[model samples]
Target: MFELSGQDVGEAQLLVDGSRLEALRGTRTCARWRWSPGFQAGETEFELRLPDGRTRRARIVTDADTRKLTRDDFDAMVRDILEDTFALFSLSPFRRAVSRGAGGPVPPIARLEFLRTRIGELEQVVARIRRAPRRRLRAEEAVLPWHKARHATGTEIVRSFRSGRVLRENHQPPRLPVQLRGHLPELIRVRRRTDTFDLPEHREMAACLRSWRDWLRAVSGRLSAASLPGSDGAAWAARLQALALRVERMRQEEPFAALPDAPATLTITSLFRNDPTYRDFHRLWRDMNLGIASVFGDFLAMPLSRTFELYELWCYLRLARAVADRWGVEGDGVSSLFGVDGAGLTIASSSLVLSAGGGWRLAFQPRYAEFWTRGDGRGSYSRPMTPDIALWRQVDGVPTPLVVLDAKYRVDQGLADALTSTHTYRDAIVDTKGGVVNSAVAEAYLLTPHQPAAGGQFETLPMPDRLFAPDYHRAFRFGALTLRPGMQAIEVAASLDAIASGLES
Candidate 1:
């Protein structure tokens, strides 16, 4: 993945092999693609087609990591990044179109594949049923004639008929023909019969069980070639295959699904919720679910798009950590001040705010203050001031904006391009009350993925003596922090420490 800053100067665009791709927001050397109409912070993946009929993975956002992470940790990191990034769009002002919809149902195949965890439960149920083969004895009623009665002090008709036969025959009653069937009652009584299989419930259950086995087999075959991490997965698949085979054999002669319930009755959550062996399967399914996003064959790729928002979130979280670490105040009650509002997930300000005790607060993409520019004594206006991260400390029981930081996705040149904007942001944004004007922010800084070009040096802005002390201006006050992969935490913390010290003066 690569990062390019962009601008909408009416004609700014990039051409890849003469195919027109308009820049979302700068020059060809430093521009973000016009992925949508407005500023979008996420990353998008595309296949970089080569002349040799091969394609390589590429992304629109910068890839921050230099090393490969373990699967579980990697998965967790992905989720954390998404959650933190998505949290920004939940800001009250910017809340638009963001939805927490991960809890919804997955596709049937994916669900079935995920259910590999319940194999243990299925096995247990199958073994228990096989051991006893649940059969019931039912009482059936029947009528018998006198000739068929052996131990019958039968009904009056049968007794009278037998006596008449005794008179008509050679002075003796006819002996009953002993042709009684299995478990037949004597002389018109109820018969107890053992019923096995052939029950309606049993047939339905059997069919459902067979369908489940078939589904498992189909899913296993579909994912057979996937090189997912975990040797145990292979063993699990093998076991499932064996189980399917056993199920097939059981279906040949007996109803495996007939043991009280249908296979459809056993869902992944319902049946495997308590099974210890199913935990890994759940994780595996989650992993698989990430691969497919929609019917257009789009996939969720690593270094996932939307790095801008992710970076903003990282800055907020890192700043919170830094403040908590330095001030010994527990950063608590982290939450989105608002929710995603309406269609297309558009955020109003995309601020992620956290409450730090002792009258301290951390915010991301906060649009609380505004800046205005007066040109030649004429009443001129500027756009609203929106900072990526703002740290507020209470002074005289009033929250004062201390340090404001901007998350820039550009490299060194792009960061350079944003220097003028930084000066404007720091100087123009002000607090006004009763015709009295004051600078709302004490200091401003830039956060970026590129390493500092001047070896951790900052650029000093020359300010009027009346506005700020000369000495304060000489220390290269406003600068950018190089946010690399391995050292983000340390870099952010160190930057925050400097910001804190700068605010102290």
Candidate 2:
């Protein structure tokens, strides 16, 4: 994966390798690309030969930013990564060659030979798994769940400052110290260095990298030997450590190897709501948010490109929800896209689709919330496509947006064909998961509530509007960026209209 950043300033037209590749954003900015289909052929190279004489280059191989997972969790992650990265082959590696030598130059006979070789190489990687060892974390890495530290220390607001707190950064203006004015550009340079990274990550990395390259070279030394130049990452780390130690030792022995240093500050907010002992947990946010970032930002490097967004899901959702709430002018109340009975109107859809993915369960409160009420919130009426809406804390005390969508509901093929569109404005999606996939039904409905808060009575008159009017930024702001609630058969279509209202800032 490579993030191609270049500005064709003063150019009248676009050009790639002296020939046209694709147009840029109004003015030329930057682009990102992944080595397409036949990745094995180009495994040893990053440069691409466009039609013209010049060349496009390989930049990076980024792993989607991952959380600090438990041993079992990390193992699962590794398995998934391996499956995705190596699954071009058949269930058995016999048919994996075609996807490998894709862009490589070779005749049919040679391609066949390459495929055979790749199969052997894969077997070496998997079969060479002599043992299932415990995965470990290093000093610089930490995926501390925001909630965990908050719970452990009983501090909802934990702040870390490098030197001072007032000089912190925010979406608003960042305060730079007068002492650091001379090094601002250097600091930015340091930050950019972490971008194009696909290297060793631990103490044993250098040796392992060396072994890996040597092994690959020895195995395919003739046809294609994959040489990893920056391979022994562990060794590189060791080298840097050695140099630092030497400096430190010299400083101790002779007191003047140190130079004057300027200081910067880092202040971070632990939590917004001061909920005590509420351990922040995550099984899905990292992947889901990251994948969404990849969608429009860079289709080719979805996983790699969106890693940062995974860590920033909170910000993204906050912005997205704000945009969604302000799209339409009128209407409010808990509304379901599946049906009007806000409680009976369930969020009937798969657990993985963008429209329905991400868990929507809140503190299971029924006294104030309508989704959990006895008589289905769909108001005494029910339809085939009507979703199951679990009335939640919809009262003034616990006012916030919610669309309770229980995904495990078992229904017939005709029923499941209804609720499957993230495009809240249009309801053209039909469920592809029939009974064959899973007959179990989840007892919740996707909410298309007019406002972030679930309940607001509209003009209590004729059936012109079905739900309560939602509060807005003028009154209360919903916490995240999300598609608004809408109906399906009785799909409320005004849920996500604010997405285009410039939410990215």
Candidate 3:
């Protein structure tokens, strides 16, 4: 059962999915309702209808509590996945285009989110720099009298002798004429070592902070001008303004305040290479230049409702990388994975196709409709089916499905339930040629984030050691692979190799 509550009910009825609950109980100031069967682990809608024929609606997101992932952990996982995906695009043949920002128009929302995250990182870097900024002992020439000329350099002494300013046994002041004996009658120029914060690296950092603040202001203006559907532009602009103010405040702080303007060309110094804070600052500076708009389109708005979808995309990308490593990507194969649109650089999520050397191909979210009835002569026997990833091997120009993988953003028992879809895909999807029916897919597998326990009681479950056995895979031609975040490259490659071994000749 589920309970819904709200304030100022005032004779209003509660509805779940447009159905009024008969067990509603409430007063004019408060209301409550109980519904049977409870809610699922995803997004749901709730509405309250007033007597004045007005209705208020809200979307409630329910996370899968069984996973026990904290908010920070989830955020870190998502960030890692996105950064990895972006790295792939950068390393591809289109690296030049990505570097030049020539992919397409960047969305204002993407820019706003990008700026916000980078600004936060910059703040952290600045905090570290403020704690222990780079400094050096600077020598300066100063005019001082006898008692204060303890650090008088040899050059200053020679200059004083040559100028006839140093008098023996005279105590006259530096600027006053003395008729009697005085020691060092005139002021002597001395060289003193003092700590200074004026360095090229510090100047560059200060300038970077200022530039980021100005960039934030410019982006805020652009966002205000652009019309965003279902978004409050004023609120976003206000938030950006606050961030800009923070950057400005940082610029006016201690170490940064003493630095001069950065040079037109900043030269890399030893401090940048040796100091931890400087190294971190330099890395963040370089990373901020690489815009996410050129690779990810509107991905900044990932809410709890779309966590599963995000996980699916992450799994496909990870598998795609593994496939590339295993078979070696062919020429220009990576270019087909991205496209340019009005919003920004768009990933070919639904219909991406890639080719590897030696007659190997991969597809993301490709549809297998009832193509047997069509002239093309391919697809499923019943209805359409779209799998997250499909691996193929071309034999004499005829494509054969080598492996089918579906990403399930689930763990534990949910992963077991997802195995049923792989079974359906492997069975219903077939190839018919010359009135002969044959199974089109050689093997089907589910990719999940579930990590099975090591020698535990749950070993009797489907995800135990038996599921990963080579004999079980060869006999059944179906299993699930654990491809969760934080997995090393070698582990992912091993999973891909297992899938490759399932090829039926």
Candidate 4:
């Protein structure tokens, strides 16, 4: 059984001896099936490759207990979902997940005051020893301190307070991330949950929870991609995940009637229209702390994931637009490339950027669409790709420099920053590896954003009217910069140009 999920653009596969089995559809949601493979159980191998790049494998032994089912059952169940079943639709990866504005600089998870208190206790001992007094005694006094109370004995008279020191207690680093501990209890608890199918309530709650988990995971993957921008993007991803987990935890705790039936008549429209009646209706939603209905309820009724997905698309589009506006990559053309699901951004960056600048070729592990079935580059892309943005050089003899670049967006970056935050890192280029490490880059026009001139790979030289403004050089304003949004295109061209110059040098 192979479950094909993701934006309907990409596909997921399950293989048993490198072949597809179609009978697993019934178990897609809950694969509570007993397997008795004819091949001496140990001889048969089972493997699952999730939509994400994570893969798991196991083999069955014919002699072992036949009742137990591992992830293969789950994988087969998921594979069966491709049967075109259920009220399926793209749940946007960009939906205003949880209110990201709640927590301030304080980690929202747990407080660490106890550990701080222990460190303070150890410091007191050290302070007392340093303040100890030393008084010398007369040699004629009794040898032992017990013999002389009034007269000082040599041994009892006085001594420096520096005999020894004891080791101080040091606490272990907390496992709780600045924001993850709160969700940890709930997320871990649901892992081995049993389905009380016999109960009407557990059945409904479990179903909803499972769907919610898959939906959250998909969107989470999108934000962590190269183009989208957000503060603490990864942290927010976790927080959103925490939100999903909370939903499941709610279901797990009560299993049924998790939310009091405040209002059976749900109207998504009221949220957008400022309807006072709808706003006051659902206390369950309010109790759960989801105020978003007031702002986006109308959109929620329409498949929350798809709207969120579009938001992510918009974010990338905005980013690409900024890049284009910055570098004037139009002459280069913008074509999309879809690469392996978990392959680094270099794959797509290599595919699209190189072709924009002409003959500077770039190759990548092809895909129908890397991020999702609906992101800008979806299934519309060609796999085992031909030149995505085929190039033809402007100058006849200028040899193009064929360079490949990658976009690195760390997950935690989302955890710490906001969507519009600047892209600067305090890290200096102390460890410059091979290649010319630039601490700064400047063009005639605007300076790069959030970084010094030396923004790597992403920096676009200030292009004149072609991109920025008509009188580009005259309007040049230097300042802190990050990689040029449009630099991928220019980089393709500049790298080739640099190669040409190097050849002539």
Candidate achieving the largest TM-score: 3
**For residue 21, what is the lDDT in candidate 3?**
63
**lDDT tens string, model 1, 112-194?**
22233234435555555556454556655444553564444434333344332232222234443232211223234424466
Q: lDDT values of the candidates?
A: 0.45, 0.25, 0.66, 0.28
The count of residue-pair clashes in candidate 3 stands at 6
Error of 1 at 54 (Å): 16
> Can you write out model 4's per-residue Cα lDDT over 228-294, one digit (the tens) per residue?
3534445445445554565444444432334333322234553313633323323222222222111
Backbone Cα, N, C clashes tallied per candidate: 21, 61, 6, 49
- Quick one: best lDDT, which candidate? 3
> On lDDT, who's better, 1 or 4?
1
Candidate 1: worst-modelled 10 consecutive residues by lDDT: 293-302
The order by descending lDDT is: 3, 1, 4, 2
**What TM-score, to 2 decimals, does candidate 4 have?**
0.21
- Ranking under TM-score, best-scoring first? 3, 1, 4, 2
- Winner of 2 and 3 under lDDT: 3
Error of 2 at 114 (Å): 28
TM-score, per-candidate, Cα-based: 0.40, 0.19, 0.73, 0.21
Greater lDDT among 3 and 4 belongs to 3
lDDT of 2 by residue, 1-505 (tens): 3344455422333222122234344334545443332112212213444323454554333232122212222222222322222221112213212221112321122112222233333333322221221133333322243323322221212232222222233323445444443222211101111221121221122232223233223323322323344333322233233333432332222111222321111112232123121111111112211211111111122222222222122112222232223322112211211121211111212111111112122221112222223232321111123222221222333222333332211122212232442122112112122212211121123232112333345334222122223323213221122222111211112333222221212
